[model samples]
Target: MAKKKYDYSPNDFVVYPAHGVGKVVSIETQEIAGFELEMFVIAFEKDKMTLRVPTNKAEEVGMRSLASTDVVADCMKTLRGKAKVKKAMWSRRAQEYEQKINSGDLIAIAEVVRDLHRADDQREQSYSERQLYEAALERLTREFAAVGNGNELEAGTEITDTLQSRVSAA
Candidate 1:
């Protein structure tokens, strides 16, 4: 038997670039086209989606373990920083934000949330802006929760608290 390229085991939390976070439900080997293909069966409970990614292609597809404590701390620091909203067109900026959210990079996702965040006193976000902000927030929250071994709501509250504090301090 060939050794697995990745060390992901069942029930491990992993981030798939385009899909945020998912749990490795199982490692499966399925016969396909006269070859045995080993794959990771990942489940995104929140999205109600299950995805099978080839084990050998996990790295190629940007699948990785959850962020470390230091990375999470850096992400929080990113949230505390100023929002760097570009003066580009809405469509262009929206596309960029979407790409960042889907990149599965914790810091990039934090930047999207920070850039699109609207405080209570600030002008309201447009429909599209709200959508992108919510998506980024959700992705960040889920990973944060997984990293802390906490619930999503708690993680989300902590994240928002950090953002709100930054706003109040500025």
Candidate 2:
């Protein structure tokens, strides 16, 4: 197999679609049917799970390096923007939110975070809504923390506080 043009290092953090953030633990080679296949071994600490993705298939699988500083800035800007909650039924909106979270696109995840966030005086979210909100919040916060050099709880609190402030100001 040709060497990957851009190979991930062991300590590098990556975003894997459907799995959020994970660290590249190492690369391994296995012989299958007389062919040596190289794989990227990624560890998702939060989920206590490991994933092996072929190096050549990384892009195809939507495995990517962390969001760049500019993209992260855009995501933060997205959080401060006005929420665009449609008047559609809850089920449809929930499905859309789930898709956004799983897309591993920073801005899309921020959109989910923005729309589901509740201000102090707003009505409490339903159980399912709350679940989706938390899931999106966790996904967003994990990336934020990874990039910001902070822990998940700290990053979560900061983002959430800013979100609440933005919602109330609107």
Candidate 3:
């Protein structure tokens, strides 16, 4: 058998679109339906969940390595930009926000966070709005933390500080 090439190796952090940041624990070959298949075993520490993804299907499932520093910088710039709240109905907006969070694009997730965020003095978000905001914030911070070599709490503080500064300046 020829050696197989894989994009990720053991102990590497990866981002799964629907999930967030997870570590690739190992790659294993297993027999299913009498055929051997190689899979990537990923462990999501925060969620306390483990996922096995077929090696060939990882990219198709939107599993990717963490963002680069340049991408993280772009996400910060996006957070500082003005929020583009639409005039659509709340349900529609919420659906859009959920999609952005699950898209696993750092910039798109940052946009969702920026758009949904309310300043301390601003009106309080509705229960659903608050839920969406928190979801987006978590996804963004997790990836940010992984890329920046910091914990999620530090990343959350840095991100919120950026938002706060932007609000104050405005």
Candidate achieving the largest lDDT: 1
- Model 3 C-alpha lDDT per residue in residues 50-115, reported as the tens digit of each score: 999999999999999999999999999999999899999999999999998999888999999999
TM-scores of the models, in the order given: 0.96, 0.92, 0.97
Task: Supply the global lDDT for candidate 2.
Answer: 0.89
Which sections of candidate 1 miss by over 4 Å?
1-5
The lDDT of model 3 is: 0.94
Report the lDDT tens digits of candidate 1 across residue range 69-154: 99999999999999998899999999999999888899999999999999999998899999999999999999999999769999
RMSD of candidate 3 to the truth, in angstroms, is 1.0
Cα miss at 147, model 3 (Å)? Answer: 0.7
Query: Total clashing residue pairs per candidate?
Result: 0, 0, 0
The lDDT per prediction is 0.94, 0.89, 0.94
Per-residue alpha-carbon lDDT of model 2 for 86-119, expressed as tens digits? 9999999999999999999989999998999888
Question: Rank order by TM-score, top first?
Answer: 3, 1, 2
